[model samples]
Target: MATANTLERIFSVDYKSKIQPIVSLCIGGWGLENLSEPNEVTIDNSTGNIYVADSGNNCVKVFDCDGKIMFKFGDKEGKGKMYRPIGLAICRDRILISQSRNCILNYQVNGEFVSSIGKLGKGELEFINPLGLTFDESNGEVYICDYNDNRIQILSQELTYKAQFGQDNLHSPLDVKLTKEYIYILDGSNPCFHLYDYNLILHKSVISREHKLQVFIPFFFFIDNSNNILIITDYYSIAFLNSQLELIHRIPITQPNGVTVDNRGRVIVVCDGGEHHLNIF
Candidate 1:
């Protein structure tokens, strides 16, 4: 929780110098090679390729920097089958997808199935509804937001369960983002963001309404290289926060669910409602 003085310090700064991120490129539609109800988006910084968890299409779509479809994997009824992939992350040369079936599927960079990671349960090595995940390049570990379980599960680079935290405070944790010094979580039920140290110690909690922001039910978020936080909300806008967690700007879109920053520091958003396309800013 934040004190009144803390809130005052956060809101005292002028946020009038708004950032206007134009839609430089809009890719995909409702057909094949297009995106439908995409839930998550990640960038391979090394290759500058974009990977989208195309939930409705039951596959992961990869596109080049120019919005050209490179390849897609995960069929409806065959090998590497996935149902409603809602979470995606890039771990070095491997890709991890968390589907609605309550398990994380591992794949190679070239779209080859490696193995299944977890199952449907509440015990160790299990998950109820894994939503958003991120790979920590500093430590080679995977952090997954176990939605229904109300916890953040830690896994090794090999996808083996290591530890879990946040069950006592997080309510419907939707997304997890990692910075070198902290771990950030977006909780849908609480409709707030929680900041924690790498040791899993809760440092602060921020509610959008407390700061006079119009963010309603943040669905997912991404932390950029500069430590700026870009949050996708159900209210048809993306809220931007500075490294100090101050509300800085808000970019309006249709209905965005996922957001990420590219290697070039461009903001990429995935609009799932009424606009099934990727908007690059």
Candidate 2:
């Protein structure tokens, strides 16, 4: 709604303490060292464990809060194995993954395959290239960013199709997350971070030319406990926005594939292109 650039911005906020790179550790630092081409990352807020979608290794690696490998999955044979795991989410005791097929596969925290959601098609209970996904624990629903389908699909905790939105302005929706009062969609094609209500009504688009930050290309974003938006972009920077969608802090970092805020309000990122697989900031 309003445009403001870094140089011309009269006021700005700093989240330097949120991303402490000096005291951070890498993926292979704790002796596990098995991740390759990791994609999305999430933390188990209740337990402080981290989950990384090891796409290249075709598995998901779980690490304790101290960065020790607890366990891993995806080396199984038959249909239970993951071919190329990308997006991941954890709810209650279930771990949801988007990979291989056009569905979101459910599993136990211990790596047992539970069930699959949707199928490969264009119909209502179907998905074509499902990418990023998140679980709304408060509602027991799953919001999946159906990449090829260009929409966000809602599924009950039972994995049943309920409703969907975002077919109008999104082309390549890469990630989706739900806050207590809003839905944040990261659309790579639209090249903007869209903010919508729980009912899926378009409210505002952040960091665009209309909002002052031109050339901003959002890749992924996370809403922290305080409801502040942390957006990682192709511009090699993380743009911080307040709950009102106003740009505050723009912290620079290497290009990162995934980002999330831990229960302690610390930032966690996965740098797929760099030497480190995981970096805590």
Candidate 3:
């Protein structure tokens, strides 16, 4: 492969052990009655609570660290009405959801309606199909993936627009993660992910196929405690990469869609292709 300036190529990656699922979740009603289409999964850093955006069911399911179904919100009724909710992120005491609206809805830890962040527009403090999002807990900042707008917007903890980036190579971006050192964006385009600095400078685009892997469809990923990037691809596997963008390990999974890491660095994946259930390793 040619040595590109932004996206470099690697030939081989270390294949680590395939961690088995410690717990599998299938919590809901029954017989196509619950968890119709779960789009994303997130973990509460403070409490290790698992939040699943049950889109088809028009609700958000909360699970404890042990995979026990705690409670659910957003039943299309009151303040927690979730219309096709797709994304989820938990920072501190707040739960952020990106659903049918162009804005991001917020709720307290107890599932009480709190406030919203952006609106439906093309400008700052405005969003178009806002999808995955993450929080910079250290600096009280939120990084959101404005999917249709092809940009990533940064906002203060108070939901004030700070800055935005990725107008050049962000085509259908899905998830946005903010680590201690860099901003990881999963675009699902040619260059699957674009890693940038805090200032939104173009650092490098991490393409999954560069390593000659079978990652045809890259969905969601999260950074572990060791800063390793765990990516869930469409080919029933998880690719692990180091902070330097080098592939380190590949774990086998079963048609995983959304993935996150718990407080204990366990891999939590939501599989919809097979059983439409959630699994934790």
By TM-score, the best candidate is 1
Per-residue lDDT of model 2, residues 1-281, tens digit only: 11100111112324655555533445533234566777788887668888888877778888776667788886467656786788888876888999857877789877888776777987787888888888887767888898898899988868888998888878889888766556788888757778788767998776465665443666666666344444554447667766656677666776677777665555667766555557766
Candidate 3: misplaced stretches above 4 Å?
A: 1-15, 27-33, 78-80, 212-214, 225-227, 233-235
The lDDT per prediction is 0.76, 0.71, 0.72
Which residue pairs collide in model 3, if any?
74-80
Model 1 C-alpha lDDT per residue in residues 77-188, reported as the tens digit of each score: 6446899999888866888899999998889878889788888999987999999988876566888999999999999866788999999889999988776567888888
lDDT of 3 by residue, 1-281 (tens): 11101101212322255467778766434333356678788877667788888877777888888877788877456545678888887767888898877878889877788776667888998989888887776666778889889999888878888998998879978887765566788887664778797667988876767754335677777765344444554547777766665666676766677787655656778877646778877
Candidate 1 residue runs with Cα over 4 Å from true position: 1-30, 75-79, 227-231
Weakest ten-residue segment in model 3 by summed lDDT: 1-10
Instruction: Mark the regions of model 2 whose C-alpha exceeds 4 Å error after superposition.
Output: 1-14, 22-32, 206-209, 213-215, 233-235
TM-score result, candidate 1: 0.87
